[model samples]
Target: MDGTKALYYGAVALVILIGISVVLSVISAIIGLATAVISGIVTLAVLVGIGYVAYKAGSWLLGDDDSASLDSIGTGSSSTSVDAGSSRQDRLRKQYVEGQISEAEFERRIGDELETEEIDDIDRELERER
Candidate 1:
């Protein structure tokens, strides 16, 4: 009876040890996978940053007028890309708020936009009269 009890206890301990080992193995695999994923993401971001910098440098060196950066790559005209009417005002306002343009620059650009709109209305009226 004593030998039988000792054997039973030894079997239970062995099973528990195997269970713990399996759990640790699974945890190690998960940690390794997470590390690999993070490394890949960081590498991708760095590559993109370098590419963008190179593109900007090349454009500057070549004296290219297309200053969209990453905004509208193949779009020729800057004005049309931003849409027409009030949306134009909204874009200017957004730029100003984002510190891309100074207060004076914002005021000047907005004034120019308003003038252009008024001139367009006048042109349409004159054409209608004709």
Candidate 2:
């Protein structure tokens, strides 16, 4: 081919190659951006989960747990009011008031009542709900 035609064709080929490179770079940038966005979201979600767990641990450690109390040694349910707590307790209280049961026996029975009642009541309540 003549020198002018050769140079013109070479320039055209170079321009085409540059155009392809630009298009490929643009596609690569878009993919990279998408990957970055997805990773950021995952990191944020993991961090939030960790933060929530930490908050619960802190609350429990600081004696802020609302489940167990001095009076009630079990999960306190606010929505479902337990109308009658362990009937055994009522009888014990009545006996104590009537001076039939000794103070020591009354205390021991009350303790036993609380322990058994906590387990049975919570299990029955959960089972009923389920």
Candidate 3:
């Protein structure tokens, strides 16, 4: 009789566990749906904000005023691309000239900078993909 009672109790416990699982699953699904909806709404709001800012900037730039000097707004200087090695050398030269660092220390730092790897394999792979 005790064996039969234990079997009945085990069956009840399994049913209870299944019911709890189903309820928790439903709650989790609701939460997940809510999160997705909230994120989408937030993304849409950010995109709209960006579009509004761009529109305002375009209108402002297109407005004609006789006294507005484009040269005053920008220095209009182009930039040159320098490699890592040359950039390090340039910094060393500047420091030495500025008297902030000694020649010997600048030489040591330049050697260390040039000898180290600036871009690893992963960075190279990403650059290649681009």
What RMSD value applies to candidate 1? 10.3
TM-score, one value per model: 0.51, 0.51, 0.47
Q: After aligning candidate 2 to the native by TM-score, how far in Å is the CA of 31 from where it should be?
A: 1.6
Deviation from native of the Cα of residue 6 in model 1, angstroms: 1.8
lDDT of 1 at 43: 100
Q: Looking at candidate 3, what is the lDDT of residue 57?
A: 85
Q: What residue pairs are clashing in model 1?
A: none
Lowest lDDT sum, 10 consecutive residues, model 1, at 69-78
- Over 50-88, each residue of candidate 3 has an lDDT whose tens digit, in order, gives 998888787688973333444344321111122545776
Candidate 1 regions exceeding 4 Å error are: 67-130
* Steric collisions counted per model: 0, 0, 0
lDDT of 1 by residue, 1-130 (tens): 6999999999999999999999999999999999999999999999999999999898888876365543355333434534586798999999999999999999999999999888866765675578
Clashing pairs in 2: none
What is candidate 3's TM-score against the reference? 0.47
Worst 10 residues of 2 by lDDT: 74-83
